[model samples]
Target: MEDKANKAWTDLIQEYQIDNAIKQHGEFIIQAKDIKKYREPRLMAKWDSSESLPTILKKSDINILPVSRSAYVLSNFKLYQPFPENDINTVKYVPPLPLESIDFNNLSTESNAINAMLITGILDDFLGTNNTVETFNGRMGTNDFSFTVNLTNGGKRQVDVQSAQLEIDGGFENDDSIIIMEAKNVPHPDFHIRQLYFPYRLWCERVRKPIRLVFSQYIDSIYHLYEYEFAKEDDYSSIHLIQQRNYSFQSSAISWDDIQRIIDSNSPEIDDNYDDTSIPFIQADLFTRLISLIEQLDKVPNMTSAEIASSMEFDIRQASYYSSAGEYLGVIERPLRGHSQLSLTGIKLMRLKLRERRLELIKLIVRHNIFHDLLSQIIDTGEFPSREAIIDRMRRYNVCKDATTLYRRASSVSGWLRWIVTLPDTTEEFE
Candidate 1:
């Protein structure tokens, strides 16, 4: 899907001599009609992350920003900002309402997650307010405004907007402030600043009260909300994080005893014919991200690698790595020519509720002798094994032969073990 957009943008760039235009005038304005000559402007221009940028734009360090309903300005400006690592130690707020109506386990979209947050009073608790009503949401036209964005060339340029399109995933307001939210389900390292900035600037022009920009991400049954503020209202480069909180309705407290129970009662026998080379050794970490990918596949099955990359806002190689990790877990199936789909085991796992689903996944992961043995040692010694110890175990299991590969694979082993150990309700460090 992204490849098509890349090629179309490449052609459009050449046809319009965009490189020359920018060199001469500091920036170039391209109309939606001009972009539609090859591909839909919406598809070509909506890059929400640095990894999702078209090849041509990425190579030139150029980003596109909409200046009006029909036009976009292309320039070499820093447009994406990184999200700070979430504090895994944050408190999880259990909503006061009963969990009967909203099924936290089956939230499939950003809208569903946001609605769930609102219903459960998670939003209220995070915002430090009691009376937050859903005041505005969805797409709306922005009033004309001007802002300055720092260019990649160490200079600044003033950009004027004329009623550009702005979309707010959710907006809640009380007496003193309006919270403008942009929500996402898949976890990305960074996001395009425009998603929050446009709506914020528009509201600032129209509202007498303060406007707060909030970015929310739903991953692995947790709602991570970040509140940001622009230090200089007219400067797009001034976005900064003010506060962040993580919440989950379901219990995430998994102790060593819980893991021991699964290990003793449900550990699968090591097959004599099991081949270590049958699937790639698990190199992908971020167990939460792996769960996120599985949930995405469960909701939209048969997604191609490019589609997955685009939706997850990661490069195609990272997409392939996560998919391969999924395959190794027996949760994802990839065909030779078609898209990737969830396996039968994945379907069954997804059908379970939040706690049950996590436990089931843990069970699946520990099915291997390496994980099972490592976990048993952790239970016995109450200490995590060192990298050298893990590498030695991999040697015994014939997991891989190359020393460099062994080290890379050992990190994944350690990562999964950390994930399992930290599942209990306690403050732990996360990489």
Candidate 2:
């Protein structure tokens, strides 16, 4: 049973893998909203009321300060500590990538994996920071109340889950305490653990402070993030699921069954290199840039690196994907700063723009016309239309031609069709 569960999440992760061809043929959907905001009211109410117990314990236990507010112990756990010199354990499988790398064109599993890895890296950075700052506001209804106030048996107090949303769990990880995250490509019933517990323990071993667990998932270019906080333990062993919010996908409740289904399906790609312990997902930026180059191409006029960059927002690595689309991936040069108004004939510019739009159009057309219909029918129960049969109807019908390609060298008619569609008369309605 345990084996089945673990395999389930792993499988779900793979299906969500951006590298998988399924994505190329997929129609991307916006990720879901925050989970905490959508959890059942009764469940949330219970969680909210649960916090009051801490206050109750503090008042009655009188010794709560000894356990929770020990300045001496906590101060010794200084936040201002420096990062220990790098060790083999901290070795970079992939070194830190610049945020600037985010400026790119299309998407691919490999690039998205890199991007996802970087986002996870930021969490590590926060955990490595030692200095902690307290940022809370306090107000006294009246200092006179201190004269006769009861914190124990009776007092004017109310606790609710209202603080959930505004609550930023785990301060920027004071000391070596990290919020360990296991990222996957799909939903896994057992994924809740791999993406949650294991990473928590791994990081917990690295530092004196407790490690929190997080699960990040990517489905069709969308990222879904979930977090878990442990409960109080006697031997520092038990895990208490304190707070969980599904912020990466849709506004819906996922049962234990939902997890099973996703994992049972295809899963995300995990690096076996790290003893199957720590695996990073594909990055979004690098992949997107790759896609962009494929989307826009030109035959007559060789496009300069700057022209490609303009379409890709200046990511040099991604710009290469453009020139090498379908054949090889290369990095020629990042788009130059200013070339939007470069000297070029109106026809030349039109051709370049069409080349670009065509790539996107091809992918979009395939997704709406093909994958969505097929995947939806198999995964969920929905008979849909295959737009491929009627691609002519929605787009420019009059410009029909023999063939069209995502690349620039497809044919002359392709460019003419694109140009004619965007032009006035004979073009759709407004013409």
Candidate 3:
């Protein structure tokens, strides 16, 4: 019965081409990867070398030292330590913290997965630990964060959506709180506008107060919380996307850090084509700082001075002192120059890049790999794995890596693959 129903819906969509709504713009995809490959001896050992997070978070309680900008924001709004309670349809905003030490040792895939499972009902375990979030199931009006519906008198009753989110009766919340938490499994990037708009419309049409949109995701070890406010008070549902005509991006929630990287990853060639009206509101210097914050390491797969220079695309003369620059940036510390043995920092950095940056780039590489595989199976079984085959696969995705001035430099990071946006699937379809 369900299959028949789904077929009918699918037939209707295809008949009317309803998929064109989102697809008319483009499909978003992340290359699929078999994550087990990353857990090899070379990489995991280093990331695990840090003191366990339990000790780190307690000592770093000085309320500073962010592992990333997103970390900084999440730390500031962490109502978790002493869970916040909802008062009167409002949430208290925690003030920003000062920096003391970056304590990333706390982040774990399981911890993140557990958080996501709660938010989206997608997974149950995180950081190898049982998710205790179910303890708060159905309990609301306790946290400074809550979602509530203000039902009016003498109106057709609307059914409240039941989900695993902290919610409360608006009348019970304090009037001073300003932020609304909208947690999702995979909301469209413009999800901010949607989450805020409907709620804002419902509330303003009934009651009156300020609203801030918060997007939380537990995909990686970090639970990203995004804050969004309308450009103007009258601007509910008034999101002006970076590109609307092309619908280049869905309304799914996008992290500030991810958005920043997208902007940074863009090449001058891409930038030249974009008008001032396109880019999001961002600071140049902050973006530069974010780029520089790339993890430093103790050892990197040991690139010799020549190989290191070659990676940097410098000539032999330039290559000779390459490790010096790497060392200067704390990227590598070698006992002697030519030997290119890694310092502890280099080894750690290499591991960090592999572990952290994998989702961003390697998954895309997998998509590229699959594209080649599919092409080989159908297009040319004989001249398989041809250069044209690879190029064609990549081209469909708009992966213009070869066209970049710093192609070698930029392509080194796997996150570079996120820029490729030509697939026939929404991020979900790919997943």
lDDT of all predictions:
0.83, 0.28, 0.29
Going through the candidates in order, what is the number of backbone clashes in each? 0, 45, 42
Tens-place lDDT per residue, model 2, 1-431, is 11222233233324444223222432111111211233322221111111111222122221110111111010011011111211111111222234565521222343353344345443343233434332221211111101111123233221111111112122234454444444444222222121232234333434677655544444323333445564532112234344222211112222323323433443323211212222111112223333334434421224555555444333333344334332212222224432112123222322333233333332322222222223333335433223442233223322223334212222222222222222111111110
Which digits, one per residue and each the tens of the lDDT, describe model 3 over residues 1-431? 12222243344334444345323432111111211133221111111111211222223221111111111111111111111111111111111123233223222233332333344322211112233233211223111112221111211211122221223111111333333444432211223133343344344444454544444432222233444555544433233322101011112223334433533443222211113222211111111111222221121345555554323322343333334333433344556646455455444443543224422322222223333243324323423344454445444444443444223322222122222221112222111
Cα lDDT tens digits, model 1, 187-294, are 777899999999988888788988888899888887789999999999999999999977876656666678889989876654212263567788876777788889
Q: Which residue pairs come into collision in candidate 1? A: none
TM-score order of candidates, top first: 1, 3, 2
Once superposed on the true structure, which residue ranges of model 3 sit more than 4 Å away at CA? Answer: 1-6, 10-176, 185-193, 205-208, 231-236, 240-431
Give lDDT: candidate 3, residue 322.
37
lDDT for position 43 in model 1: 87
TM-score on alpha carbons, each prediction: 0.83, 0.24, 0.26
Point to the candidate with the largest TM-score: 1
- The ten-residue window of minimal lDDT in model 1 covers 268-277
Best by lDDT: 1
